[model samples]
Target: MTPQMRHRLVHAGWLAAALAALGGVFVLYVHPDFLVTLVDQVWSCF
Candidate 1:
């Protein structure tokens, strides 16, 4: 493959990862209870 194509593929992969992360954040914002539960579970380990 050409260098340009490889570069584009890498960029697209990064974009997809960023979008997925943003979506996860949006879900947490939409349902704060989920985040609270997650934090609670983590704190319980202490």
Candidate 2:
């Protein structure tokens, strides 16, 4: 890949990871029950 393409991809990956981390923080601090619901949904698929 070109240098510019590689740079863009790396930046995008970092942004996605940062957004995911922020979401986790919000869920932990603002809505702790989100985790419980998430687990329940996941288990329900079984």
Candidate 3:
């Protein structure tokens, strides 16, 4: 592939990865149990 095409592909891949991560976080946040557990775990660290 051309250099420009490779650069675009890399940028697109990063965007896709970020979107997937956000989606995963959104799914987790949609569950009340997950948020409670997460808060408990964080609170335990202090």
Best by TM-score: 1
lDDT of each: 0.99, 0.93, 0.95
Q: Model 1, range 1-46, lDDT digits (tens) per residue?
A: 9999999999999999999999999999999999999999999999
The local lDDT score (0 to 100) that residue 31 gets in candidate 3 is 91
Identify the superior model by lDDT, candidate 2 or candidate 3: 3
Which run of 10 residues does model 3 get worst, by summed lDDT? Answer: 27-36
Per-residue accuracy of model 3 over 1-46 as CA lDDT, tens digit each: 9999999999999999999999999998789798899899999999
Q: Is candidate 1 or candidate 3 better by lDDT?
A: 1
Instruction: Supply the TM-score for candidate 3.
Output: 0.68
What 10-residue stretch in candidate 2 is worst by lDDT? 26-35
Pitting candidate 1 against candidate 2, the one with the higher lDDT is 1
How far out, in Å, is residue 4 in model 1?
Answer: 0.6
Clashes of 1: 0
> What TM-score would every model get versus the actual structure?
0.94, 0.63, 0.68
> Which ten-residue region of model 1 has the weakest summed lDDT?
26-35
